[model samples]
Target: MESLKYHRLQQRLGYTFVDQKNLQLALTHRSHGATNNERLEFLGDSILNFVIGEALFKKFPEAKEGQLSRLRSQMVKGETLAHLAREFAFGECLVLGEGEMKSGGHRRDSILADTVEAIIGAIYLEAGLDSCRDRLHSWYAERLAALSLETTVKDAKTRLQEHLQSLQKPLPEYNIVDVNGEAHAQLFTVECKIATLSQSATAQASSRREAEKQAAAAVLARLGL
Candidate 1:
């Protein structure tokens, strides 16, 4: 990527690096070469968990430990990180190897998510924890504002399972009904079957995990739980 692109990215991140090289390495993927972003990713992941954990604790003082943990998990998951990456157009700045480049690694969720963490690490190394926390807050402002204990009491699957367990009912089962589309843009159709329900709840999404979540969500609606 060009210097102009990095400058634009820094503008989006709300933090400019004292040493631009750190940012460069943060944007580098392992596929690019040996000295890549893996270590930085490790550091950044820890920092993010700590920073977000503290933020959640302060924002939701009444939340129990389990609620806080689940909320943090949702925030730091690969899906949410990838969403943040897309917000900053991280794909345009990622440095990938030839093979990964040709295979659309720039748009891959795991890759994008890792780069976001790497960037967080880079920011900390260039400046300090305060800068890193500020950037995270900027990126997550809308999401933080939207969080509610009622809406995220539990994930759809967890809620469904708990409802069943409460009544001494058997657990729900999930199956892959179909998978379609190309390698990078595939869609998964998952069916959720509960012993008490006459019909199965089905949903489709870009990944099996997401598909299952949707299917579980559908089942939640069906059971009115």
Candidate 2:
């Protein structure tokens, strides 16, 4: 039953492991035991960066180094990886400990993202770099196809920074004004201040990073950019 459950994930990944233990280990969370997927996640992160970097380099000969770096970052970031994990129904196959499982750790973005990377590492170890590359390419086909120098999907912070840089204006400043709630789930209130603008934008989210992003987006909307 356990093996059959993972077989479904393998089909989605488009690669089956020779030694199924690799896949099992890759899905194991640190909370599950000492022998977990952390090492595999690290290896997979490096491989993912290299593979995505090489792909971007070939796909866009005219792109600058910064552009390629941004593109690769966008592709390999936790949010993107978590989205891929959702696509593969990874939450159902994650091997979390009793506490983590009870607390809905399987649905966590970080855990899902880490598991995806671990799986990548497992594939690399099982076969080779070519297999890993092929799987990544297959998985990221739509996202890769959508990439373009002009339409690069950038975060609000990056876009705001670039906008300020182009206009020779002072960069925006972010300050955390307030934090509410407990340790596990806190609401952060961040204010984005622009030197030229008379008014600042404030936003709140579950994390400081997200709050800052929302504030930046609000500032951008004010600027009419």
Candidate 3:
């Protein structure tokens, strides 16, 4: 049954593993056992950065170094990887330990993001850089097409701040409402409040910065920006 599910995931990914064990290893979290996807994730991270950077270099020859760096960062960020993971329905395919399973580890952004990288590494190992690059290009086709030098990719907080400034409203305030879990693996809840607006937005994430960013994004959504 599990193998059948993985087969479906391969179809979705548009790459079939020559050795099924590589696919299984890529999906196995550290919590599952000592032999897990951490090594693959590391390799995949480097490959992703290099491939995306190369693509951006070719796509925008006139772009400055900073612009290329920022573009690559935006494309390879954990949030973007998590979004891709959701699109691929990767949560159901994750292999986690009993504790992690009970705690909804499969749905975690970090886990999903790491799993995506791990799969990339697995593909590189099984085939080669050419095959890995082709897969990445296919995966990021829409996102790559959307890129442009005319508009810079700004983070949610920066966009929110600039938007409010244009409307003659005071900058938004962020407050930490709650913190949960262990020190190393904490969850932070942040509330983003705009004085001019009656409604505020709150979001939770593994870090304060990320939670604040999410809160700001929520406020932007409310304002239809």
Candidate 4:
């Protein structure tokens, strides 16, 4: 079932194999390949840690182990791998049999992410670490943003800062523009500014910090920042 197009894609990945079957096996879904990429994915998970961890070690010498570990964790998360798989359009290339295809298998994160690891394992098997590392870095370039989504989405300030940084900058600034009426019935107007983009919101509160957060939310919506 080899095709020139698939072969060209394999060449782009930089690992041409004698048995292309392992590579094919890696791409197969459980519905198609029986055992599927699960086992390969497990092996790839460790290989990914080894490769990305080594990368972090070299990339940030001054970073403490905690910091480096955090970075690696971000890279290898299921959501991150799923996003990375999309970037390479791996979802489109997944070889699902009739049953899995009918079940929308391509959209499954566990499946797609496992395929990514299996492909990495296939690379490792064919050409070893250097080749596999190169393919992985190229594949993972875009999903690094998923890391900036923060340790959790519940922290608005952290999310906002990360969104800004993904654009290569720091958090936006909010300034109190006006306070209207009397102290008992005060209204605050706060402006959130990021570079040239600005948004303002007004809220009644007993203190300034609460009003600032409202303004920040407005700015986030304005720039989608």
- Provide the overall lDDT of each model, using Cα atoms, as 2-decimal numbers: 0.90, 0.91, 0.93, 0.69
Tell me each candidate's TM-score: 0.78, 0.83, 0.76, 0.59
Candidate 2 segments whose C-alpha is farther than 4 A from its true place? 165-169, 176-190, 196-211
Q: In candidate 4, what residue range of length 10 has the lowest lDDT sum? A: 147-156
What would the per-residue lDDT of candidate 4 be over residues 1-225, giving only the tens digit for each residue? 447656866665556667878877888877775657768877888899898888767766677776777788767866677876776667667888786687677887767778888888877877788888887776665544344323423334455677888889866776787787543234566666667463344443324555666666666667655
lDDT ranking from best to worst? 3, 2, 1, 4
User: Over the stretch 123-204, how does candidate 2's per-residue lDDT look in tens digits?
Assistant: 9998999999999999999999998987666789989999999989999999999999645446799999988799999999
TM-score-superior candidate, 1 or 4: 1
Q: Weakest 10 consecutive residues, lDDT, candidate 1?
A: 179-188
Q: Candidate 3, after superposition: displacement of residue 102 in Å? A: 1.5
The per-prediction tally of clashing pairs is: 0, 0, 0, 0
In candidate 2, clashing pairs total: 0
Q: What ordering of candidates by TM-score runs from best to worst?
A: 2, 1, 3, 4
Candidate RMSDs in order: 3.6, 3.0, 4.1, 14.2
Clashing pairs in 1: none
Scored against the true structure, residue 90 in model 2 reaches a CA lDDT of 99
lDDT of 1 by residue, 15-114 (tens): 8888889989999999888989999999999999999999999999999999899999899988999999999999999998888788898998888998
User: Which portions of model 1 miss their true places by more than 4 Å?
Assistant: 172-225
